[model samples]
Target: MLGLRFIGQGFAGLFGLIGLFPVMAQAADSRLQRMETSDAGRGWEAVGRLDVDGEGFCTGALIAPDLVLTAAHCLYDARSGVRIQPKTIEFLAGWRNGRASAYRTVTRAVVHPDYIFDGEVSTDRVRRDIALLQLQRPIRNTTVIPFQTDNRPRKGADVGVVSYAHDRSEAPSIQELCSVMARQEGVLIMSCDVDFGSSGAPVFSFSGGKPRIVSVVSAKAEVDGKRVSLGADLAKELQILRAQLTSTRIGSRMPEGVGRVQVGGARSSGGAKFVRPGG
Candidate 1:
């Protein structure tokens, strides 16, 4: 979700922070019914909510049974500005309202090496702003959303975004059905408005019979007149994610835990790492 507010031509809001998009509760036009049974082949049972400490949280979709995809910037240690230790995090599946249907522990995190949190127009951070979390066990939810892998919608295609943004927000709600503006660099920019808690929510275009995720919410674009947004390509990132997810051991489930460690800044900085993209 991108905002229309102007911080600066170079200021692209938070690299992984929630993009400020206007939130709206539109009618559910989706023809895709919530599946009562899990589709194992499509990796549908992996979507979950990521919670850290108590305040910092974000939405995550499952790309595999044991792997969850989200914005790399989401794992930052805002206080220390460094990467949070994966062992301290937890993944809750089918998270809605205030409760998660199923939960698991995150053993490790694999973020895009090219992910640069600095806010700059020229930097490729916005396009590759993705991260993968390996869950300790496979979540057994039956109502998993399938990833869109075929017939990707073109620019201006009607699409919807869903997320449980804010504590009050419910299941990934549909904001606005805007069209795909353009693929700036490699990022797919949309016209839909979003907010902070909606980070990592899936952007889907209704095609065939189900809503396929064309892109996952990365960062929202700002505008002076035109409203545009950008999303990391799930197709490309999933390639790297598949290799990592398979190599890692699914092993035993991790016990529930909630604590915070430093992330994203210099190891000794002891605060959120602020890296400005060089113009």
Candidate 2:
């Protein structure tokens, strides 16, 4: 297990534990575009913000009509170091300007069996840092279609991300093109820009005509002095989480509280911190 590094200020700050830093200079083709209106983000209705108990939020995507995918750490309480109640979480699909295309409450959540809220950064943690949330009701809306996931992308492959950052929390931003810098262990280091409230955002690959989720944003890190975003290989982790959710009932055994706290910044209302790349 590789040790994690802590840096930055609180969630509201410019950069925090989860790595929400100033946008680094990138090619003109890779800038983030704010999805201010519904028409501006038509096909991305499945991606939305996961508001946890009205405290703070993280990015999440609907993988199934009733299943949402996000980072496991987002399910724990940053201050108390306990699992948050599933009922407290709400999925705001295509959330923009305080309105959402679809709304569903969480009935249960299950994290990867190997994930630990130990307040450390490691390949193991990042690789397995994923979770599945069962919604209170199935979102069978016509416009909000769930996304299918595929295998991880090869290094140097072009990828894209849609997320809600702290500065642009009201609306989601789309980075249509970024490159995967490297693949180590079960983690991917990519040049994709991210910030606070971007955790659990979906990384998409457009190998086919439509987009499929390839990874979930876990943290922002400085790899060899270069700013990069970290994510889990969803190919295997997503399968494991699905099995865990189906094999056992997560009703009574579910822990109560927000997820774990990362190093660097103070705890936010969501109990997680944002990391700044190259801070």
Candidate 3:
């Protein structure tokens, strides 16, 4: 139920009054490429849309054959603050024009221990806003190769993002050129174009020849008169989620008569909207 409204300069001006500074002096290129054809989206098969009980969606990435990385907020019911059953979640890899390169159900999900879904926008919430999903089956297809993950990128480093926003939900879009504006308190502020349904989208760093995930989109905010996206550093959070997943066993069946919950309410400063990735 998360939604976005572009307020343009007025939104930026409000942030300026608060003495916050724009991360990037000039706007970074965040032009999106519609991955409507296989040829156009050849190497992006690992990124996918996570469908939550047929009600909402969030962006996610495959980090291992049977493991997916996303935002922890995606796993909670925004209205009741209850955790959604994992069996109801599904991953549609390389989804494009009603088709998918691979499909798999979620067996279990582990959220960061420090993540709080209290509807507050803080460095703590943003920094710990990560989760890991264990897929029912491994995606070993040639086209759907999982991506590798690395530490957060340095400030001003060039980054990229692939996400499914409200306007462009049918097919995923890749912004090949974005910039990491700042790093603070284990959180990353980037000049990446993101909106509702883009939560949990993977932010990639191309330090090596191949693309590696560096952070996960948590929210969109106006920082010092500039529109920017907030992300969680994955290094420590990923390790915690992985350890939890390995040690715990998730139930196979879901509780009976679990209904879908709607999520939308008040907005915070900077016109910020708290999005629950797949909720």
Cα lDDT of model 2 by residue, 164-198, tens digit: 98778788999999977767788877888887778
Candidate 3, lDDT over the whole model:
0.77
Q: lDDT, candidate 1, residue 162?
A: 57
lDDT of 3 by residue, 11-46 (tens): 221211221244553465758788888898899999
Off by over 4 Å in 3: 1-22, 25-28, 252-279
Sort order, lDDT high to low: 2, 3, 1
Candidate 1 per-residue lDDT over residues 1-279, each given as its tens digit: 443332222344433333334333233434222323333213333455577654445677766667777777677643444566677667777655445567778887776766665435442765666678877877656655435443346655677665545532334445436666655456666666655555676777676667677777765545535544557766776677656655655433222333343323343332222122221
TM-scores, each model vs. reference:
0.69, 0.85, 0.85
> Regarding lDDT, does 2 or 3 come out ahead?
2
Go through the candidates in order and give the clash count of each. 21, 18, 0
* Residue 211 local lDDT, model 1: 66
In model 1, which runs have C-alpha deviations exceeding 4 angstroms? 1-47, 118-123, 145-152, 167-171, 244-279
Q: What are the lDDT scores of the predictions, listed in order?
A: 0.56, 0.78, 0.77
